[model samples]
Target: MIQHIRISRQLIFVNKILFVFSLFGLIGAPHTHNIRAKRYFFPLFIAIDGSFTEVKVNEWKGAASNNRNQEEDGSAFIVEILKNLGADLVDSVEYGDDELTQILLSEIKDVWRRIVNNPKSLVNSGETPESLGIYMAKILFIAKDRHCESPDETFINGKCFPISTRERSEHCPENMGLYDDEKNEGFCECLELTKEKAKSELRPIYSNETGVCYRQNTQGPCENGEWFVLKNTYPRCEPVPDGCPTDGRHVFWNPDNSTAKQCWEIWTRGPCDKGQLLHLEQDSTEEPQVYCSYRLAESFFTYSALSFPPCPPGTLSNYVGQCIGCSRGCYGAFIG
Candidate 1:
């Protein structure tokens, strides 16, 4: 009986030790790369207002009949990862499987041609063509963040600042209001004026005031409105879509930024209820310019007037773009 009891105790002790070792083995083992076997693309953009927008791109593996469901699922998985990485809004842009194969191949051939012609472009020392290809493949799989001459402090390590604070920069443009919160305290944002203020204080009229329309009780977008008065401080209208002959593009001073930056005239698509206006091209060399270049609070966006519903504090938008109460709770809330 004593021997049996001792045997049972020894077995129990051994089992405990085995269990601990197994647990450690599982924890310290290298993670399998099943999901990573597929290629993917992710582009993260930081808006001037300090909002983080991530574009989750689907994988393109040079197979014509690639799976749509797989692409979508991978994109969704990436968006979830981005949200966990402090993304404010996540959107997906997908292409058909193998859709970009031709384009990429053409670009690669072009690069190769350039290298063959100018051998100096391909450093002969320590860098082989295969090594260059590897680096290029890495770029396609995981792109590096784009650098700017001046980056806002709110952006760090491909994520927006987590903390929220209220501080204003003395450098805000004239007539533009300054708003700052903890997460974006380091960004510079001009205040949006209310319609009432636009009408009363900074009364604006079209460049051709011959028949300028006016509404006594009309309001300007204090926040979340589509149209913003070009110049907030000294409100005045310059000949735009209707006023200009639409023959040629011209440059004018923007009213929002107190700085001296000349804004160029841009044409808009027929999305305008009126009609699409034409403009003279300044340079065909620059990327094909389009109309409706309205100034955004940030220099990053030009003439985007889309608006979504403003959700209350402590809530976030659902996958369907509807505002819902946050499950994890909101740390701070402000209109961007």
Candidate 2:
């Protein structure tokens, strides 16, 4: 009887060990998800000031589309490195089915106004809707912050520093490095505007005033509702990078960062959009310039892929073009 009891005890011990080891193998093993999502949102500034004045995009806003299909842009050569980074989680592999890039229309509208009145003010490398709004708040910070009695100089990064003539160097054009620095990630210093500080206007009423339109018909864009306004800042527009295609036959993709090239095609049926505005030439020597809207954010985007470029912190794993961000509410929650 004692011997039988000993055998039973040994069996229980072995079984418990085996069960725990199995749990580790199953729970700790890497899981893979195939995702579909968008990576970019086109900023469209609409004047809520109430007037017959329709925000017109003189460049490609209302232009006819023979080449650029608004909805058909599911796959092209365009890509997003950050969206591709979502799959790099511990014990996880993200597939095209697991890839996604999303933006909230509400959030997009909330910050869209900032770029409207200040054409030069744009969402550069990492500007999201919330980030832009946060920056805007700083601009209007004094109006809200009773303790603070001045207009603050906010950096593209959201750092707020005192506004001073000597501090003029703090402006990005004066210091281009600050534009790309992660450390400058907040509003700049403040300036003592008067008790009645005016917010940036919605749209410049006159050409001589301070407003310009913002247009984007290029590679890597997926969302629309492009906006415009009268900007007060000098140079009043984001300078298109010289590398921007002045000439080429390039494809685009979906905003979701979907990379299925088969989904994109060059239609010979009619005229394309970009060419109509940029006055593109098709001479073999003149290289065809094309701004692809959607494609794999990464060259090897999920065709036996490993990981995506990192999404901003607090993003969700969802459909292509579908994601959640902490700053922009990528998954849709305002943490602060």
For residues 75-188, write the lDDT of model 2, one tens digit per residue.
210111111111121111111111111122222222333233333333233554345435434323322321222223323434444433112234522211111111123321
Clashes of each: 18, 81
Tell me the deviation in Å of residue 90 in model 2.
56
1-336, model 1: which lDDT tens digit per residue?
A: 865554343333322222222222321235542222112111111112222222111112212113223323332222222122111111000222142333233333333333333334443234444454344333222211112111122343454432221222344333222322322233322222232222112122121222221211122322221122333322232334323222223333333456553444344322223453323211101222223322221221222112223221222333222233233332442212
lDDT of 2 at 280: 18
Q: Can you give the TM-score per candidate against the true fold? A: 0.18, 0.15
Q: After superposition, how far is residue 25 of candidate 1 from its true place, in Å?
A: 43
